[model samples]
Target chain A: MAQLVLSNVYKRYDDGPKGLFRKRKVHDYAVNNLSFTCEDGEFIGILGPSGCGKSTTLRMIAGLEEITEGDMYIGDIRINELPPKDRNIGLAFEDYALYPPLSVYENLAFNMRAKKIPEDKIQEAVSYVAPLLKVDDLLDMKPPALSGGQKQRVNIARAIVRRPGLLLLDEPLSHLDGKMRQTLRQEIKRMHHEIKCTTIIVTHDQMEAMSLADRIVIMKDGVLQQMGTPLEVYDDPANEFVAGFIGEPPMNLLPATIVGAGDGFEFAFEGSPLRVAVPEKYNPVVENNMQVTLGVRPVDVLIQPGTEGSGAVPVAVYENLGDERRISVRIGDTLLNTTTAEDVSYHHGQIVRLSFHAERTHLFDPKTGNRIRSNVEWR
Target chain B: MAKIELDGVTKRYGKNTALDNVSLTVEDNEFLVLFGPAGAGKTTLLKTIAGVEFPQKGLVKIGGEIVNHVEPMHRNVSMVFENYALYPHMSVYDNIASPMRSKLYKKDEAYIRETVERVTKMMKIDHLWERKPSQLSNGQRQRVAIGRCLVREPNVFLMDEPLAHLDAKLRHFMRSELKEMQSSFNTTTIYVTHDYMEAMSLADRIAVLNHGKIEQLGTSQEMYYTPCNEFVATLFGEPEINLFPAEVVAENGRLYLSALGQEGLPLEEDVCQALVHREDRSYDVGIRGNDVRFSFEHRPGWMAGTVYANEPIGNKVIMTVDVEGTHIRLVAPNDTRAGLDQPVYLSLNMKNAILFDSVDKSYVIRSDAQRFTQTAAAAGR
Candidate 1:
């Protein structure tokens, strides 16, 4: 097992004005100045939108893409120029990428034999992996005979058979259905726990990143938007994008106008006014009458009712979520989603007060997604 | 103003029966969802309801009137597919206005523009009116498709997993939006999807289908807490309802389960009497992980288990606990540092337990079990 690091990683395609297509730089940077480290035996996720260069970063680590200018290291070895085979990295792409002609057993043993590992060790490796991946009975079968999950499991087992220093997975669960994806997700996590190999997976899914990774690196437009543990990214996002990207109904990103913001934070939208206790940290940088994006997670947004003094917005829209009911209400341009963990029903368009926990609040710059400088981060 | 009714609906193509003997009634203004796994007749049923496909042996009625022979266009039902199916060359305005134009609305161009404006504002796509389909995001395109469907204020709507193509985050947002849109119109919509979350979050009631048959149809709460059978019990919940090898026992003039994990549970005599009187001893006791409490130390009523794995889900965690050689999930509150093989006790909250008949495998709620199984056998002890 090994820890990997990339500093100031850059990937520029040969298109447009410069390389691939024309004189116009289609993308100034596929990946730019990206830096993060995956500790030994830790699983880190690369999360971003499709064009945000998550794949490029993974490809760079796999030596499939060349880094324009960066320092890359795996454990103590700097493998900037090493061939992929010499890097001793195991990779599993979204397509499974299994050799169709070779049987499951032969495919797994191919890499081991190529590396000149002993035949006894090869046999021992297959025996050990087949049972864990639940593919022991399909050793002699070809990829054509295996189901999607089985194929992916076999592919995963094949990737880990060599016992590479790191495991790289690229959207391995994208092709599977919901239930199968979830089962396989658990299987992969269990596999990681059992093998204890430092792993890096790239995906555009926030749920996948939150569920599987010890830490998540969120990228956008080739820039590192945020990098932190999932909880850190969820609770205290570094930017508006990160805050909006993490949770469901997404952190309600509403444009807020700073009213009287000296000691207490005074907020008013449309016909409603709300007073928020300013975290002493943000109070310093948050000027009065400054424009900021006020964000709150749906789970934290409380439903205040029947209070005449600015407690609730008068609108209830019904959402039947299995055992619970979620009510969506509009406060000016922002929508608040309140969930009741019960089977009760609520009339739509009924006005209800919404009060947010000030401590769980987030403020971001309107122009840049960067979190508003505040006293909270220093704490 | 339409209540859809199906009687013995069966559609056969060659050797396959897409829909079989399906009889159902969708009340007027009711939001009915058709849910099933792939090839389980969810789409086929929707198509049949839309009058695009003919049923071989059943009558389909809309608004208290049978419309099995109605043409696709005359049924007043608009179908939206998983793909937005918008014209690429036309702007969103033209795409939305196409349905109205096809229906031969002879209102002046001003009325046409006014109608387009109303739907555009409602869908929040007013700013993207000039953009063509190729220039829009998947979500934007979907809004246009819905806008097109809503142009004439159609009485009944059919959406076939319209949000399936988007990413997870976008899909969540769109589900809420779609539900809001459906209720706002009050058009008595029939939505179809393979996603449990979508079905739960959006539908007024869900029709669970399997192999051309309706497993059950009820409100989301009914479907989750009170599933009628093994398939329904296992299909709806997440971390899945933990099924354990439990047997019924009677002691101290009370009903209890003689299980190994916990010393014993004060069995709900209703569920047990139902199971045991049915002469079913080898039964799988169904319990939700959320209802199961985990403790660091073993208690008398708590079952002993080893922590198998913990799956952190941001605010919460799903702990897979192994009890007596079987892996059962335990939904634990987040901010926990419980690790592998950590010894713990899983307490079964008998109040929420659902007992299944090991033989024939049907859920036997209190009264029904007693009625059917009184003479079958003695309550196992």
Candidate 2:
């Protein structure tokens, strides 16, 4: 195992012959001045939506794409100029890319054999990784005979068979369905624990990143937005984009303005008769009549009766999603979702007091889309 | 609006059977979802109803009329495929207006403009009126396709995984949007999806298909609470349901479930009654992840196990424990953490478990079947 370091990394592509005169050339930076370190045996996830340069960052690390600028090092050795095969990085992509006619065992051994490793050593490596991925029994079967989940397992097993210093997974579970995806996700976590290689995965699925990675790097529009543990990003999002992008139902981001209500100020939702008292800790950063965005997750919104003096919004949508009940209340043109596990059923148009947890509530700059920092810290 | 009925429909191509002897009725204005895995013939069932594919063995009826020989263009049914089948050359406005311009449903330019704008605004794509399909994102394109379908006055709307291509956040947002729009649909609908969450949230009643057969058809509550068999139960929940073989032991006029080397786990009165009439002693106990309780501390009557895996999803943590040889997964709070191979204790809520005949994997009994029926009845409304 080895620590990986990237310093001031930038990947830019030439946007050529596109100007009105067709003479000006411009460069579009897919990855903009990114720097991060993965400690030995650490698992990091590069998470973002499409065109966010997450895949570009991963490919640069794997040496598949050349670094447009900056330095990359694996342990104490700089690897920016090294070829892909010499980088000792394992890759498992969404496509299995396994040899169709080759058996699982043969597929695992194919790379090792191509490298001219001893026959006995090749067998030993294949034997160790096959059981870790739970593909021991399927080793004898050809790739065409395996199921999607089984093929993914073998695909990952083949990547780890060589005991590379770093493992890179690119949307490894996207092609799978729900049940199979969950099953394979757990297996990947367990496999990471067993192997403990410095691993980085690129995925658009927040749940996959939250579950598998020790730390997550959130990106957007070819820039790093935030880097933290899953809980850190979830509970204390640094911006409106991070807040809305992290959760399942997503955080409710409503445009509001700060207004004075006696001693303490309150946030008045735009175009709606809804107001929530601002937490005391945020008073230093916020002012009355200042436009802001109020952010709160569905789980942080509480619905109680007989508290209409507080913000009371009529339920516009109520859905029973088996394990949880999702209640959405209309605020102007958009709806704010509130999720609960209580057995109570709510009807549409029913007036209910919706209170935000003071500690869990978030305020953002409406213009900049950045979090308004305060002294509040989640315990 | 019309009611659709498929009676003993069986479709085959050479040696492969896409749909078996299937019979279903989608009431007028009711939303019915067809849910299963990839090859479970959910798409085949939807295609059969839209008159795209004809079944050789049975009849497809729309508004009490047999449509076995009907051409798809004349059926007055709008279909949204998994892939957004949008016109690449046309702009978003023209693509949505294409349906209204068809000969069967042609309308004047004034009405077409009004209807196109209304559906586009509702679908949150009103600003993309001038962009071609190639310029839109996958999510945007899918919404445009659905908007085109929504602009028509079809007797039935058939959608196959409309939200499958969207990202997690957008998919979640659109699931709510679809549920909100369903009430105003006022048309019979048959939706197909491989995602359980989409099916559970959108369907008034879900039909679980497996290997060209309908395993069960009921409300989401019924499907979740009292699934007909083990396969159906596994399909509805995350972490999959924990199914382990257990033997019914009778002692001192009381029954117990012995599983995973843990003995003397008392069975409830209702379960005992159901088990007394069954001829088989062996059964597969099915328990959902949330029904199992766990702790790092060893409490009374809790079985000991080793931590197999701990995954922290957004709101909750799914912790797996290896008890003896079986791995049981449970839902823990988000803050819970445990090291690998750490000692843990678990106790099953047997009252909430469903038992199946071990040999055939068919439903034997559940202690609280009455509660499922009540909730399902309420949900159906």
Candidate 3:
């Protein structure tokens, strides 16, 4: 396995012309000035929503799309003009692009056969990777007879049969149902453990990226948003978008104002009586009456049941989601949600105390949508 | 406003059966969700209730009156299909207003304008009022379709995968929005979706269907804690529950259940007595990921295993451990870090586990069966 690198990679699409004058060439950059490095044997995930340049970045790395301007490298060798076939990379996409008429074994062996490998070596390679993905028992069956999950397994098996230096997957689990998707996700993780090839996965699902990747590269509108470990992004988001995008149910971003409460400052919500003391780490970073957005995940919001005078808010809605409970309280027009593992039940109008964890709370600039880092250096 | 009931309903197309002997009752103004996989007859059941598809062998009743032969238009039920099915030529304003302007439910222009604006704003599609269906995004079109349905005072609302087209984040946001508005519905609703999260979050009651049959119909608590069968148990939780065959052994005076090559897994007194009285010596044990506890360091009464995989989802981590020959999965903290083939120890929380009869693959008992049996039995399960 070898490390992969991209320096100032850019992909521009010339839409060409507009408004009765076809003279000007309108250049649309799908990926702009993207640069990152994947160390040897490391697993990296490219994460973003649809049309956010994630797929375009993956295609550029695979040599499927031409780079408008940049340098690409695998280890120390530059590979900008290299053909897709010449690059030692394996690809598996959302669709199971298997040969319908070919048996599972033949479909896996087809790639090696085209490379002019000997028959015995081809059999050896196919046998080694087949059981890794649990497709060994279906070797004789054609692609038409397999289920969607089974077909995807075979597709992954075929990609890894040749054991290329790098493995690339694009939304590989998007087609399966929930249970089947979980099973395949675990299998893919196991396969990665067994074969430590440098891997890159492109997906819009944050769960998939967080579970599988050692580090994640987030993008938005052809611009790189942030790149870090899953926990790093979760614990301290670089911006409001990353904070909102990285979690399930997303994070609650409410507009608030910094007001003086004795010696310190408190975040006061608009049209509501809720006031939270600003965390001590941000003391030197803020001023009184500053407009900002307060970010807190549902899991960090704690609910306390009590009588009046203890700061209670009526529950707007309570959802029993099997293993956990999701409670929502309205703050003016916005509904702030909190997730808890407690088995307590609350009705629509029940009053409860809501509090946020001081250490886990975040602040973002409302105008720029950027995070406001603390003045104190924290790990 | 209305109660929905189906008695032994069966619908067939040629040799294929879409719904078979299905019986269900949805209380007045209740939000009942029909949840299952593809081709599980969820949509078919909804259609039968909407009078779009007639049952060949049974009766359909609304508000205790038999409506088996009623026409779709006369049923007074608003239905939203998987596809938007909006008027391509009209703007969003007119599409939402058309429902109020129908001959059977016609209203004055002033009332129509007021109701249309109110519904569109609630659906967050007010800005797209002048945009045609073709110019809207998939999410926008779906909102318009739902807005049209919400504008009328129908007895029942039938929605089929209304949030299926939106992306994950938008779907999540809209689900909460839908649930918040459900309290104001004050109308009987039958919603169909294959997503378990939505089914658990929104449904006052969930009907689990498989192969054109209702497997179980109950509250989310009953479906999670007291599932009727192994199939229903596997449908609720993420990472899925771990099911393995376990053998019961009675030593001296105490009984212990053994599996995964480890013997003497001490059971609680109630659980031990429940299994000892049974005639079967072998049964299936299902442990959810959260019920299985693991430690990197060996602890007393814990079984030794090898770390097979560690997947850290955003909120939590699902760690798979290899105990003997069987792979056991458990939930871990998000910051959990482990290397491949590392030694790990696991201990299952038997109190919360569900036991299934090995012969029929049906739930026998759980140690904490009383937690849900009271409510489930009261619901006439």
Across B1-381, the per-residue lDDT of candidate 2 in tens digits comes to: 898998999999889999999999888888999999889999999999888888979999999999999999888899888778899999999999998888878899999999988888787789999999999876578778888888887889999898888766777777776776666577788999988888988888999999899999988888888889998988887778999999999999999999988898888898898788878899999999988999889898899999988888878888999999899999899888889899999999998889998999988889879887897676654
> Cα miss at B154, model 2 (Å)?
3.8
CAPRI class of candidate 1: acceptable
True contacts kept of 1: 0.41
| Model 1 Cα shift for residue A131 (angstroms) | 2.6
lDDT of each: 0.79, 0.88, 0.87
lDDT by residue for model 1 (A1-379), tens: 9999998888888533544554434267898789998899999999998899999999999999888878899988888899998998999988988899999999889888997999999999999888777788999999999899999998889989888899999999999877678778878887888889999999988888887898999999898988898778888788888888887557778777776645776665654454444455577777778888888777677675554555655653677665346777766644566655554555666756667776788888889877876754665
Fnat for each model:
0.41, 0.59, 0.72
TM-score of each: 0.90, 0.90, 0.91
Candidate 2: chain B TM-score against the reference chain B: 0.92
Compose the digit string of candidate 3's lDDT tens values, residues B191-210.
99988889988887899999
Better of 2 and 3 by lDDT: 2
- Candidate 3, backbone clash total: 0
Fold similarity of candidate 1's chain A to the true chain A, as a TM-score: 0.92
Off by over 4 Å in 1: A15-26, A270-281, A340-345, A376-379, B83-98, B103-147, B151-155, B269-277, B366-381
Report the error of model 1 at residue A117, Å: 3.7
Model 1: per-residue Cα lDDT over B187-276, one tens digit each: 778999988878877776789999999999877666776677878887776767777667766667666666655545776656555555
